[model samples]
Target: MANVIRRAEERDAASLQHLQAATPGMPEWTQVHWLGLLSGDAIVVIAETDGEVAGYAVASLLRIPGEVVAELEAIVVTPSHRRNGLGNGLLRYLLAEAQAAGAIRLMLEVRTGNGAARALYQGLGFQEEGLRRRYYRDPVEDAVLMSLQFPQEAVAVEKGQE
Candidate 1:
């Protein structure tokens, strides 16, 4: 499969939106919200495999006061695309893209039971920092907050001294 990861274009909204809805363990975001993000500063990325959309992820550069952070809003891979390093590629792309945009950190919240996602994030240097009570509905899943420091090059430098 020639899986290509690229920014989600407006032309992909309908297909991407359907994929988002079909994705298990993903939040239901309105079509309007998805379209707004595509039209705004948010980063909506899609992965195409064999000429078909395989997965998508959404991220945002958040600014507050003097602080800047990159928030990975959603990362969803069609079950068919799982276990193929597609998730890893999308995350690495987001991390590098966000860092280039001046993000000092990357943050996200995943369900406590999502070991796959947790492990993936941890492998990329993200750490568990906190939790949100009942952040997900339709079963009331708690959110486990995770974050990774930006500029991964700095992490390598610091590790080299250890």
Candidate 2:
């Protein structure tokens, strides 16, 4: 599909809120929250085609003394746009940005019933690290904690020293 993925803007808040509402199991974020994130520390991107939003991804970083940890807050694609690689594209964008920002690892939690999302994460090199019981409401499901660790050796390879 001819979709463009770009940094989200304040004007995207309302549309994103609507999309989040239509997506089951997604946290309902207020327009104010979305607007605040536009200027906040999170890395947020949206995919659009024909001026219509197709998907979006949000990620935030936590800095430690020697390393950066990134959390994938959310990734959502409209039902009509599912299976077209929009979600994959959004996630790949976050992964690249986080790595460039010095993130040593990426983390996220998904409801156990979300097989599709879990599969996507695994396909992208995430592994199940732990589980939180009853971490998701509405249906009260377990949350599978997943993480992807970037190898420090990659720096040497990128620097042409390997």
TM-score versus the correct structure, for each prediction: 0.87, 0.89
Candidate 1 residue pairs that clash? none
| CA lDDT, candidate 2, residue 47 | 93
The numbered model that scores best in lDDT is 2
Across 74-152, the per-residue lDDT of candidate 1 in tens digits comes to 8988888898988998998888777666677989999998899998999989999999999998789999999998765
Model 1's number of clashes is: 0
> lDDT tens digits, residues 18-75, model 2?
9889898787899999988877878888999778999899998898896688999999
Clashing pairs in 2: none
Best by TM-score: 2
lDDT for each candidate structure: 0.84, 0.88
The TM-score of candidate 1 is 0.87
Ten-residue segment with the worst summed lDDT in candidate 1? 153-162
